[model samples]
Target: MKYCAANYQFSFHSVNMRRMNDLRGIDLNLLVVLEALLAERHISRAALRLHLSQPAVSHALGRLRQLLDDPLLVRGQGGLVPSARAHELAGPLAEALAQVRILLGPSGFQPATARRSFRLAMSDYGAMALLPGLLRAVRKIAPGIDLVVSQASREAMTAKVADGEIDLALGVFGQPPEGVHSTELFEETYACMVDAATVRGLGKLDQVAYLARSHVLVATHSERVDAIDAAVAKVGGRRKIACVLPHWSVAPALIAGTNLVLTTARRSLAAFEEDPRFAVFDPPFPLPGFGFSLIWHDRTDADPGHSWLRERVIAVAAGDEPDDAISLRS
Candidate 1:
């Protein structure tokens, strides 16, 4: 005869059949009673601890002796003493009970005292737009919490979340992967950045001037087409690509001395607001903005720590306070 256990098929032979049957008939709650009885020794004390009658405790002890095939407790000169097998089971039984208590108890996450480290996967652009505020908020509230950020491609974020490699991911996911939950944080629009000294006669760039100028393509990953390029293509226009780079950080410095224009997310331009060398303007065409979402696996959906982290991320993205206990930095 074949039996299925956790997707595996195995045959039970005569040698182990009784052990499996014993396990099937075992009541897990009896372990709790056994643990209490072993700790208290006396039936009355054990009943008090377990909120049961003395007779109930004695009956449970009788069941325990039959299960173990040994008298767990016996009378001695001073008081009830543990048998050899009971003494052998005490240490491991105590450890297992402690683990079960923790598993059954509340998650017990206190942000003020929690010393947790979380790994996040996001594109460089998303990090640039969100990290400064997120770090500030986290530092003031969860001072003990730590964050590790990684740059993952759009294709890899879903797998990273599902495999427990990344706790959360932030990006413009048009179609999120199956089994992943996402909440839209905000809609992000594009802006054209240029050097004030190098570019002239461009107050608000028209499609004609936008396409005529050389552009620095901020391709953080090796994708062939970006949002701006796709938008321009829809309108039967294309910008001249002078160079392609892997990060948004280098685009400002590269565009400062040259006539190259960089088109990227509007939130990313906040870093260059006070810099006299860079100029920010709206994109020439009416390009559709993309929505940024916080994505996590279903496995973490009900976890208290994971829920707290997601709330913080959403609050920071929405430019609001996390809670009354925590305040955002100016």
Candidate 2:
């Protein structure tokens, strides 16, 4: 059934007299419970969503039924079915509560004391570059805050951010999806990693020497063609792509003992800068660099916790300790 503001207000008026008499008893928390109850349609399921005991949820439902003078949900064979009044309130109630969340904001995020979990999406390369220091900072200060990181394609990550499935994402982006905002964290350029032993103690590759060896490609699925490939085209030769994989983390292992060339972000090979077995060098050809960024939906922009997390991420990207948060932009 299609719900409208007019219909929702009309239903609210039916109980307005009773609510007006007992206005003091109408709790926002109770309404929150009602929203979950209406959404779950099962006492136990609602309790799980709210992190409350089943009896507690039942008590809240009892109070809600008394306040609204309607048995919002009734027993059904499957679970609980919403009554006419509940159907009327469901859509509008959810809409109103969403607005209320935006209105109140996150209040404030006290990372030292907060017991919250955040979900972030990024590629394996992003994880390699950002996770080490970010994790250390989280452990030192925000012990109560937990992070869950997952990897997916840029399109999947952006879609998840838009749908509220993922809180934040970090990567190089082309054009972000609608309602998503992105800020550049840092700039990265293409670099070639090769087995130093086979490359004859060379710190860099010449144009002819670069195309002679087999290459390990990190196909991000964002694009098949990149700046180096364009550069190689200008020189009238193609890279011998012996292996094409989707992850940057595994490239080092593949290029360690073989005469394989892996061209990827400089940060991807930064950890191996000191390793004598590997040589991370600039390509002989000129390749345009890309800006790595952090992206999240506008829905999370004002959230204090999310903003705090974004600060920490940006701080890490800038090679700063996350002890004090920095806001690059308002």
Candidate 3:
């Protein structure tokens, strides 16, 4: 039976009144006993269904009688007859139980059948490396879905995820504040990128050659220039820092036609592939490898659409070609 809002309000008010003027207080467990009592009719059978002793069922029935101001069940030739009052409550109570079931039930999410906007935050390098493949893969699966990508500062990232302001985050940082989950997307090796023409004119880069040439560094929030100094100290070297850039994305354009060698993620080098002037080569000395990851709120952990999006991101991170049947990134 369909339950209207008016009927639900009336039923709730009726139950509330009985509780206000009850014998001391009403036991909510009495509703379970009342349900079983109305279903089975016999006290022993109601007790069996409720997993209560017969005496306990009888005691609950007594309290229910006083609370409802009705016998609730009457012994008749039919075994037990529900009082008119009990029959009156049956429909509304059943509807209430069913509403709760629907609230907690499993949800169906079909990407092709859904139109949802996913908001994501990541650094420009992260976007350059993963978004092209990620977007292509998702389009094959969910043509109608939309994506909103934006740059986010570390100070605001965790709060944005917690408030559902952003769906996911991808970057080199890890260990988000409590209530966020993170997974390693991939490990990134750094390479020195410079103009191929310039490198040929300058000859092979040695410690002295590297020190003599101007260098561009992505400053961000790290003391990376000092770290480079310490790492190359054993080899008796120093680098002449010519510029400090705020983001890795800006380095490509700054060194596009110059002799300045800038270090950046190899995966991100794809952004500069179209420029023939630029070339990526291994650093002559050892450098740190950056590991990027995807982060999201725990609340979205079991959501089907969010899970699907997260999996696609991981696939893109693993260097998968989106058109193939089996994504290599997986």
Candidate 4:
């Protein structure tokens, strides 16, 4: 009687083992192809969406059939009709995929506690104007996280964010590239800068006095000069652009002892605004109030660390100044 009971248990265990093996041998990629097929109901369209050729999609479907032991998709007068088994599997498979995505997606980032290294690309002016406040906030909050800041050319900035060469970018920018997100940090008009020593010695500047002085233009490619030219055109004037620099950080040092005047963001010039050696003025005509933004790749949108970094940068760059201090710094 003991031997009879043992033989019965062994038979049940063997059957269970075979079922587990059948499930284990099913390829996950094939499941994904099946999900796509179930959605589109057209092989060619699903192939294009998955970036696979039509033949590859068909091969995956063949493997899916052998594993599932069913003609999962059947062609009918109305197009492909999912078999009853396919309909049953679809709901559970989709639910399982959703759960998997939630489990494997990026972790939640906490700025005050997280340890991470954030990469950023920006001009020197952007770095000087924005980074100090951001660094202060980081040191106070996420001190464990390090920041890697790099210089980027105008042409390469958008592509760098898109390709993940950098995690985020800060600058005066136009439209963001596809697959990127941008949040406006601040907007301030341009201010004309001059050496206080030169202005003091040469006397105060009127519109003519401004145009007569030499200019130090920050040209990000040649179009910058043209933009400046058009801004000055209303005054029946053109600047004598004696010096050109790629960034605002160097512009301050260059203008310190020279007669050359530069035009830049008020935020960029904030540090120098109170200094005795520099003078700031409004341009002859409005030189377009451009927006400074914090931009990042869409792929990083769900990443906790990336989100934290972007949030802090925006907060600081926006100047989160208290409403009690409503007086504009005129």
Top model by TM-score, which number?
2
Ranked by lDDT from best down, the candidates are 2, 1, 4, 3
Q: Write the per-residue lDDT of candidate 3 for residues 1-330, one digit (tens) a residue.
A: 357988999999999888776846757678767766765678887676566899999999998898778998889986789878887775455334334333543464566655656768988777788888899988888787778787766556656665555679888665687778999998888777778787675533666666778888776555655456666676777777889866767788888667887766776676666666776777788877867888987666766667778888987888765443432211
Error of 1 at 299 (Å): 0.8
- For candidate 4, write residues 1-330 as lDDT tens digits: 999999999999998779658757667788778877875677986686577899999999998898778999989876688899997776566546544543664455455555555667888878887788888877777777877677777557776666554668887667887877888888768887888987776534677778888888887665655566787886678888888877677777888778788876777787877888888777767578777777877666766566656667767776762222122110
TM-score of 4: 0.62
Model 1 pairs whose backbones collide: none
Residue range 1-330, candidate 2, lDDT tens digits: 357877988888878866667748668798888877765679997787677899999999998898788999999998989899987776567546555765764456667776656668899989998998888887777888878787888887887676555679998777997789999999998888888897775676898888887788788785767677888898898988898888888888998778888888998888888898888888888788899999998777867777788888888999999664533222
* Model 4 residue 93 CA deviation in Å: 26
Provide the RMSD of all predictions against the true structure, rounded to 1 decimal.
16.4, 7.9, 20.1, 16.0
Off by over 4 Å in 2: 1-107, 324-330
* C-alpha local distance difference test of each model: 0.76, 0.80, 0.72, 0.73
Show the colliding residue pairs in model 4: none
Better of 2 and 3 by lDDT: 2
Sliding window of 10 residues with minimal summed lDDT for model 4:
321-330
Compute the lDDT for candidate 2: 0.80
